[model samples]
Target: MDNPTAGIDRAAPVVARHELTIRAPATAVWGLLTDVPAWPSWQPDIVSARARTPLTPGATFHWRTAALDIASTVYAMEAPRLILWGGPAQGIVAVHQWTLTSSGPAATLVTTEESWDGAPVRADAANIRQALDDSLAQWLGHLKTAAEKPR
Candidate 1:
């Protein structure tokens, strides 16, 4: 990792974390993950994504998922290794991070974690946690399929 990972809010009422080993190089997985506009193609949970501004620190991107429109700002980014982004949506504040570690010649140990805090999340912590867990799992599965695709 070129840069240290930025963590999610520890005090957040709801948190979800998931990790998976993908049979693809870190660079390959990072490529697919960072390409926001192409997210809907691989990550079915996302309805759309657009980043008119380059994905540097403080740059914001808008996307829709699970019927919620989210506008997330790129908080930190370390190419092929880590990225942290989040924002407020539907009265909930979310902080999400993705970390990719090269495990072998063509493998990556990828981890995704998110923290949520706000009235809605606190009101239904159990359901929100489960939903975030399911969403992250599906995201990892889809990334694995996309990155492992024959080039």
Candidate 2:
């Protein structure tokens, strides 16, 4: 399969990827993924998220996290399957992508990958990579917990 991060600079210093199976239908998981405004409620790293326009290609959203405030544009969207978004933040260029697959009637396998490039990232590649790993892991855990909870 072609790498989703292929478009990102191969020289990127920090890259993180994580995946988990969620015991919830893809429809349920997709809803949570696309609802940008509700991110802060479950995503501990996100302080706030707002997207004035629908999450279509070229649409932009503002996100605030403990590390930086970033304005990202949605680059692609494939319904309950995939979404990709990225932009420059705090002097770093980043691209993030999520993929979903229906493992069964009530289970979805989710994967997320991110790449960071720029002088800032290169200056502290090890620490940045570790941080991204931790962040992505936490995000997947939170999503799994939320998705699997009895509703």
TM-score of each: 0.95, 0.92
TM-score of 1: 0.95
- Candidate RMSDs in Å, in order, are 3.4, 2.7
Per-residue CA lDDT of model 1 for 101-145, tens digit only, reads 999999999999999988999899999999998989899999999
| Candidate 1 local lDDT, residue 21 | 96
Q: Candidate 1 lDDT (Cα, whole model)? A: 0.90
For each candidate, the alpha-carbon lDDT, in order, equals 0.90, 0.86
Error of 1 at 122 (Å): 0.5
lDDT of 2: 0.86
Worst 10 residues of 1 by lDDT: 1-10
Clashing pairs for predicted structure model 2, backbone only: none
- What TM-score number comes out for model 2? 0.92
For candidate 2, the C-alpha RMSD (Å) to the true structure equals 2.7
Please give me the total number of clashing residue pairs in predicted model 1. 0
